[model samples]
Target: MRYEAHLRARALERPQHAALVCAGQRISYAALADIAERFASALVAGAGFGNGERCVLFLDNRAETAAGLFGTLRAGGMFSVINPTTKADKLAYVLNNCEASVLVTQASLLPVARAAAAQAPSVRHVVVVDAAGELAGHEVPWDEFIAAPSILDPASRGIDIDLAMLVYTSGSTGEPKGVMMTHKNIEHAATSITTYLRMSPDDVVLSVLPLAFDYGLYQLLMCVKLGATLVLEKSFAFPQKILPLLESERITGFPLVPTMAALIVQLRNFRPEWAASVKFLTNTAAALPPAHIARLRELFPQARVYSMYGMTESKRCTWLPPEELDRRPDSVGIAIPFTEAWVAGEDGKPLPPGAVGELVVRGGHVMQGYWRNPEATDKALKPGRYPWEKVLHTGDLFRMDADGFLYFVGRKDDIIKSRGEKVSPKEVENVLYALPGVREAAVVGVPDPVLGRALKAILAVEDGASIAPRDVIAHCAARLEDFMVPRLIEFRDALPKTNTGKIRRAALQAEAEGRELPGEDA
Candidate 1:
């Protein structure tokens, strides 16, 4: 089935049904489908978009963002949603990497969008939402862009194996790598995840996660697939504002990460009665501590809390059934439906139960690979047990109980998962190194209850440099995304090094994880 199938079916079957509710406006399925179809027409007639072409959506979580997304798919083109917080350089890099033909953005972000699009020769059109009448030769207003006459041919719809999305993720080497996924892959992941979550058309789910994130994107896709209602919020930063929606919207499904759960734990005025309608509460990114889990149960007494684990590569890996949570709150549960996951040692052999090893997942939900990066693709998608198959080797360490329940140990790589968003230390360090420090720079993830893994930057600057923490923060703020900026900064006279003169990153990581570094009191 196509990704936009639900929008079409819902528009026909439940025309008046509310599909999305965001920012005080409610959009019906029929309205959404019409918008998507109009957008499809616009893509073809206005931008000369073809069946394998790419469209980059750089906007916030709103009805328009949702429409632009399915519209690209409806038009048989691939789409990528960049985080609204992404800087111009990264945005431009993604545009160039995907060779996007169209970019859907807002007038407020035109400065950055224009800057990025100026550098991207592949971009043919910049569709601006809420723009004034004046426009550039290559620019078009949202209203006029969607007004194109329909010229779609149903027979031309592509097959499921065609590329459907390009989700750019943080690379280990200070760059962004696009994760490639086809329609078939997305369908499998959405189906497998929804099957275990017990989602249904009757459910009204509330999502505060960014659409740029796969976790949040699926919430929209699955809701539309089931004809369910999605109440979108910009963020969970203000729990007080979002808490009331649980009752008003009759929200049954609540998806969160460790950071949101931590925020929940900090709410003193939280009333369990406020969430009486909530049926399913899910968490991922980082497993919640047992005490936090216990507290969550008391907070959402009627809701079944599911602690899940996954990444963009697989979309989702494991989901702990709510019934089994009390028994093993620390475990991220078993492999999702229609999938196989096992732990393997360094030698690529299966590890005995209870032995920590890299998690290996074999499933149709596995991403196609990184876009334009075959070397990285080979590293992640290694040969499976069968001759013709390849499996995803999640760079994470986990141990399984004899019963097959998996418990997370730690990451095999240094990609810091902060606030449910992956932050490459190298990427952050690259920005730090360019801050005129005149010396050394390093970044590490420090264990934190709230942020999942708070980013900390350690530096040894020149003797005469007068840079302070605020100055460094300002410099990073001007360059990197907000999530990539280091929250904690410390200066040292010297940095630890190996006998070979290479900086020891692990030493700093261990210190941030609570152990003392060399020359410190043990």
Candidate 2:
């Protein structure tokens, strides 16, 4: 079923139930549904948005953003959420690539939105939210658009197989590519995930991850799907502010990424009461270091910590069950409920347990393909066991244990060969995290005539914690094999991160290559 239908159903069955709490606004199921329908009227009447057209939402975590999501589908059109921090050039590239019919954004972001929409000829309307009375001639105030009489005639709505949303993720080529997910694909994935999480209407979920990130967006969608209350926030940059919401909202489910968790673990004077109401904690975007996960358990003693692995191509691939967390902290766990995944060798056959190979996933959650890019799609979606099926070939390398638990090695291209021996950066980085002073770490291969490519350790140490190159090298040498240890090490105040807070490894690799290698030998 379409995501919009879930909101409508909740509105009809439990109109008075609280559906959303954001920015001092407590919106009920009935109110949220009305907002969605009215926004649909705005899209259809104001922009002439037609069936299957694209609407790009350049917004933050707000009530209108949620309304816009469901409204686009209600109008039988697909929607895309662009990261609010995206610059004009990149945003324009996405707008043109998707040929977006409407651009929905907030007043503060109007500068970049206005510039990008000006370049995208396909954008017919620029709908501005959170604006004052005055508006640019080309801009349509959100209040005016949604407040107008309901001019939308619900003659048609999207079916199960129609595209529901386009999630634009960073492409391997540095440009962005939109991952198209259908209503059926999303429904199945959402159902399977919520079943595994055991979420219900009584649950109150809180999230600060961006709407542009699929994981964050699902928190909003899944909560609505189950008739639950969602307490949405814009950022976790200041945990002091975010921490209070857990207790204030009586949050049951808390979803976070590794970076957020890192900050939480380091925060001083964390009150036991802050986590008293949290029933579970879900983590992805990257596996939490086993050491960090242990600390998180200490912090949220009552909360079940779930470590998961996924990509934009497929919503989620595997989740380490809370029951099995201590036993298998290193593994990303089995494939998420109902999905079948295996490690495939170069010959396109399943590899035996304990052998590393590319990960292959077969499920409804696998994205149909990249939008308008068949070349990349062909490389990712290949023949499945069934002739009619196209399974997603996740380019990441992994190994499954005898019990069918998967261990992420690294991305196919992320593996570094040094001293004529292959090295997984994740493995080295995991050990680095165990160090007392280290907060964040990324390992990359640097040019070396002797070792072929030397493993270099780049780290972000904790504040006021003194860490030296020798200290890092010595720690790794104690735990890692000779070739697996780094040959050089560097320290930075903070490692570069994506908008989602993932360490920008590719950016580091490129920067490392341009500069001359350091050391007397060089």
Reference-based TM-score of each model? 0.97, 0.81
Give the Cα-based TM-score of candidate 1 against the true structure. Answer: 0.97
Model 1: per-residue lDDT, tens digit, 1-522? 777776888999999999999989999999998999889988987788889899999999989999999999988999999988888999999999999999999988888999999999999999999997677889989988998656776543688889899999998887899999998999999999989988889999999999999999999999998899999999987889898899889899999888788788888888766789998899888888888888888888888888899999999999888889879978899999999999999866789999999999999999999999999999999989889999999999999999999988878787989888889998998888898854888899988876778888899999899899999898999998888988888999988887777778878888788776554322
Candidate 1 lDDT: 0.89
Off by over 4 Å in 2: 151-156, 414-522
User: What shift in Å separates residue 11 of candidate 1 from its native position after superposition?
Assistant: 1.3
Clash pairs, candidate 1, are: none
Model 2: lDDT to the true structure: 0.85
Q: Top lDDT: which candidate number?
A: 1
